[model samples]
Target: MSQRYHVVDRPDSRAPLDPRKLAQVLAQDGQLLLPMLDLIEHAEAAVDDLIDVMGRATIEAVLLMSAAGVAGPKQQGKRADRDVVYHGSQAGRVALKERQLRVTKPRLRKRAPQSGEPGEVEVPAYEAMRKDGRLADRMLEILIAGVSTRRYEHVLPEMAETVGVSKSEVSREAIEAGERLLKGLAERDLSGPDILAVWIDGIQLGPYHVICAVGVDADSHKHVLGLREGATENSAVATALLEDLVRRGLDPERRRLFIIDGAKALRAAIDRVFGADQPVQRCRNHKLRNVTGHLPKDQHEQAKATLRAAFKLDAKEGMAKLEQYASWLEHQWPDAAGSLREGLEEMFTINRLGLPSLLRRCLGTTNLIDNGHSAARDRMRRVRNWQSGSMALRWTAAAFDAASKGFRRIIGYEHIWMLKAALEEPAKDRSLVQQAVAG
Candidate 1:
């Protein structure tokens, strides 16, 4: 067999080449074609070794450029008038992407203008590379993506001399990042978003209960409003969460619909904070589950169908059908009947508002907020222990912050205007009623 090689012509060595243009071309192409003989000779080299070689070369180039800016050229003759002088090189660690890289950093010293004291001059490149603020962000992202702290080091790219990958350091970075996220979420301004509805729900993390509020704006965009830690989803916890949201810029007087799981405390808190006149919608799913949970398994489908069908009717007709269903259950399952009757009117709030079917479906339940809670739970699944309420809050905030990035407009967002109109009608009616009474 005869082996044939493809020959390529080399560029003229006499031609003046721009280093920056060559770099730009290489960066854009991301590869260089080598001679066949050289390629064959280096075929056995591992990719990891090549990457290390390239990284070191790039770092050296950057340091040289940075050094030139401060200490001038290396081979230049010494001058007494020089303001800065090379102070030799030192081994230093710089943050490189998700990990740290050890490099030889060139040092320079500056002489004081009046006093002859020497001051250390910072290498711009080294200082820029040494900033590890993004390292904390990367750690939080990895941890939130389900990488455990113990396994954090293993997940990172292998480096020759990396630091801050130990389990303790990883934990500290995640804690600091989580605290920042918690603070950011807590302090976010809610007044800017023209929120048309708010959903409140509680999730239990170990022994702690956290009440979370998510708002749906006029454009059907959801915002994580606030969270409060409590022993349970009690009136105080819900009240505190709502108050925090209001304090952060959620308008208390805004005619927005309040959606909540069938919790009396949550309903009470809404009435207390946002006023009793603010429309409240009980989660139909929670209501169905609560009502059916009291009955035999065989009766679940029938009861659920009845409740669901009733939700589609007009407010009066829906309430009447629910009342009839409650009466039927009262004979055999008074608990089920009571559950059905609980917050009965609020279940029909969306229907009473005369919203379009699409808006009604979107606003009728607490699923908007529940979906965010699901994302938060998935992000926090690796957390084995909840050390304290603050820890739980921190993790929850970080998880939700990560989750919010993937959120899109709610389903039936096109009909969001209908909801806005529906929410405003009651406020308009109340104003008119008050005026008539005053007259």
Candidate 2:
């Protein structure tokens, strides 16, 4: 008997090779030189051919192993009589990235029918194909790319027509994808990243609220750290989000800056989770809006300009100037005065630390988190009704993950080293103060 062999094309086959195409392939740098049209035609054929070859090989290997008594009898193992015999192959199908291919799997049965039980022999090849998730992944990718479920038949009539009507299959696959993403976000180790600052904020979707934390690393790159579902931005919800990050290896003791809107719950959460002395920079923009809302419409611009001018002064001078303005306003508008005095020291945190204008511009506001919320909202704008908190969390996680792709270093990022130095100053001073108190 002669052994059959299948031949493949040679890399430089001179069999009617187009010289222009060959020249282009040679001149190009590292890249796939296969023609697009040819790949589409041959890829499916290759997959089918491979599956059929593997199917036959699997059966042949099983027969050989059975005859050799590999699974029949062994020392200290259950012994089987020579009653089991080979049976005809059964038709099956395996999913591949290109398409589904038909396969024939051989079976074995007892020579004497004691019972209707069939002998089970493992097919490693078929199992490998079954475990290959590229087909499902590609399907989900297409769906995310705006290919509607109804159009799957028209999009890939040869490969995905069955999938068009299998809405449940698509849903199951999407759920798996979403769970994987959520798990990755939640369980990722954060100790490896040199996170220099955290921007925290809450976003509302229908009746659910999600508090999200975005971290800025030492290199000025941004990361969506984690999120928690909450009914409102309360201390408990904020604390849980921060604690989860800590459990995932975020060092709460580290003197990283915390930039947040004027939420007392977030401030308290930071103090409780990180430390009472942790450096917190209240978003100056939010403060400005709150302060100006108390003044008359005609006085708003002047008040904003006054605060802006005060921010340009040094920390001591800025605080004194703001305090003077508060005193002046106390005569007529006490509410506005109280607003300026509340968290007044935090308003000039960037100034107190003496960071560069560019770096301060990035650290002085919760704009980064706000921008992430805006991007996330844009991604989920089509969602009309968020049925449950879990649903909102899933969709928000997906949206934020999508938004994270567009994150670049904050503006004036080159001077980030200055911000890092400033963040360290407070911790150093506190240690010194503690030592003095001990003395």
Candidate 3:
């Protein structure tokens, strides 16, 4: 037996001894992992708190000592006890962090996480969680939450105790803290997404560009990449947006469907960025309005019904119903039937396969993004009209970040898979279609 390394059969300093002689520890204690992360986190928060306290305390001490008779040269010469206390506290913090760093040992991490040999290696599970890139996400949530959400109450009226930067020094500190988090998210190497679809479109925020990327995540739930400010909804920005999505951990190969409303810039951008073959679908409900606009008031309801039939979760039956409705419209309402005859059918382009909940929700007209947009608009509506484009965009983005905190992205995995595939091309699957009975 080597004296340098033992099986830990005898209890060690990390875990208690003499409790169970038969079982050696399977891994280093995971409980320590959280504490380790917290240790560094608290060290930082402590530094911030100290700065605030020292600033206020030093100001108070100076005023008090001056009132008591210390003035001019004497006041300058008399060093307040507050300075000594502040330095002492800071020194303690330095000592505390040094102790924590000893145990964190982030540098000890393996060069190769997997050796490819199948034997099990003892690893602390909690450490493994952050080791596999989850640390970035966890840290992102923490940092973004701080500046981007509740913490920003200092910047505006609605939310927090810290209202208005109140002072220039506080403003600088808050801004610096926010930039640190945003810079990390913006610069990190985002890879390995296995993306199944990409939702690209320039959303309206008063008059500014609010291009966004929405799509399914690893667990197959939809995630909103973010709202880009000032970036044109044109081909250049959309292309850059695609590349950004890739950096934000989206994989292009896994994504096949591109859903958007028919904005000329958005369409051109997607094509210029993603190329012509990228499977695209116009929002179904949005198209129906155009379709019905051509109809007589009396026929609008009938036309809507006909259009809705095509969106049935069943492909074959919907197609047959669509044909019957088209025939009725073309023959009976010739004056209003031309647009439907020419392009309304294309709206059904992705619905012919079994509807994926994502496609189904998207195809029917109102995209889930539309809902978020609506929420933003409701807030902006209070302003009557925004004073400037930046004002509108900022309010909208902040509103979304605040409101979407509770928005649970529906992945509709099974639906998204079929919807993505069906969007690829469905003429081949046309023959596999049978009349689907309504549930």
Candidate 4:
């Protein structure tokens, strides 16, 4: 049929416009739109896989050299010169990495039977190039950022007159690689950490929310631990995340403490999984704000001083000071004070254990856990339009994982007794818990 093409014919559109060129550009742009992340997943897999493949390939190459003498030549009885060496072969690796399959021609020297003259033996090139391996290490670093920082399309460069990588290739390569690798961390089995502590917090990235758990070993070394997403940092959500950790082999019960913001659900989940048997320390800073809320604004400054005094005072002074604070709160705002004072009561109970400094440091609102979240938030703040909760978790897992790396154990061994004793107790004796901590 005679047709009228619904096409725009502007000066830039026509003269001799090409549809393929347009479609190619459009398709490429479309690929860039794909939610491809960095090559983080395949990077890990590739590192392992390449090590395996290259490793086996090198072995096979050496075997070939052996066979050149054992099965085919007299020199086969001698040691193969290649020896599957790990170093001094940049050319071999460069070619192998670039090609996904490399072909290495091993040179063999032997005495010629015909003339007793030295003749070099030619061995077929053992292929060692991995076509997808180029720029992977370099691209890997970028890919990790693309996924963690969610900088997907901007990952590539060399695109224009001004300068930048073409968006399409960047998407096709870096992000696809990263996205694949990022997925790996989700499915891979994580070994159980000593888990001296589990620090939990939620991070906001654009529209998504990610709850992060950082685990610390007995030695105080930390791991990213786990990540989850939800409407709020509730116990159910924290429990679900902990469940996932269980599925992945993390033993929460074995963890010494679950360091988290003083959220009910988190506490509930800890009690559910670890039981009230484990020591639950309120983050000290949160406790201060919480207890101070019971008093009037005019009294807050004075009440804080009183509460601090109680926290640091000897047993009897601490008791009287707490009662004084509570009595004042009951007079000003009974309900608020009642609710706020309940937690302060827990703090007092923990402190009576004689693990005074440890109690103040651990059972109180934990700046370590909060500090971890703050750093994570700062890093992911720049990412706009986070795609989903899982997407946010990816960024969180990497960020929190990276942030927890420097955690140092500030609590001393002498203090471990109160915490350890509290953990061993059968009943919920806040008094005994306090005694152990105070001791």
Model 2: weakest 10-residue lDDT segment is 29-38
lDDT of each: 0.76, 0.70, 0.46, 0.53
CA shift of 214, model 2, Å:
1.1
Worst 10 residues of 1 by lDDT: 33-42
Q: What is the lDDT of candidate 3?
A: 0.46
Q: Residues 1-439, candidate 4, lDDT per residue (tens digit)?
A: 7988796667766465443344234323333312211122223223224334333333233423433432243342465444322111222222222122222323444532358654544332222223335543344345333343234444433221112334355445544444554566566565644555566767667776677676655554556666678633566787887788777877555636665557777878877776675666555566667766655688778767876777776555676677776776787578656765565545554455455675456545556666777766666555666667766665565555556556766456346555655545555576565565456
Candidate 3: tens digits of C-alpha lDDT, residues 1-439: 6577555554556773431121112112223223333442333223222224332222222222222221111234455543111111010001110011111111112223456643222222223222232222322233233343334334332311122322343334434443443454355454644455556555565556677555654446655565555444365666676667665665554426666765556667666555665656677666677667777788778777767756763545665676667677787666455655554434554664456546466544436677777665664453444456545445555555555676774545445556555545554454345233222
Which candidate comes out best when scored by lDDT? 1
Q: Which stretches of candidate 2 lie over 4 Å from their true place?
A: 1-131, 134-168, 295-299, 327-334, 426-439
In model 4, what is the error at residue 84, expressed in angstroms?
A: 26
TM-score computed on alpha carbons, candidate 3:
0.52
CA lDDT of 347 in candidate 4?
A: 57
Tell me the tens digit of each residue's lDDT in model 1 across 1-439.
9999997766776686553444334333432422311332333322223336555444545555566656766655666456877777788876644566666767788855457654888876566556536778778899988889877777877554555467887789889998999888888988799999888888889888888888889988888888789732588877888888889998888888888887777778888988988888889999988988999999999998998899889888888999998998999999999999988988988877677777788789988888878888888898889999998898888888888888899888998888887667766685674455335
TM-score of each: 0.81, 0.67, 0.52, 0.57
Candidate 2 vs candidate 3, TM-score winner: 2
Arranged by lDDT, best first:
1, 2, 4, 3
lDDT of candidate 2 over 1-439, digit per residue (tens): 9999999979768775443343323323213322321332333233333334333233233223332332242224444466664444565555655345554444545666556554554444445444556666555545544454555556654521223336567656756776777888999899988898899988999989998899999899999999899832588999999999999999977888889887888898888899987778889888899999899998899899999898888777888899999999999889999999999988876776667877888888989999978877765665666788887787677777777887899998898888788677766685774455335
Least lDDT summed over 10 consecutive residues: which range in candidate 3?
A: 89-98
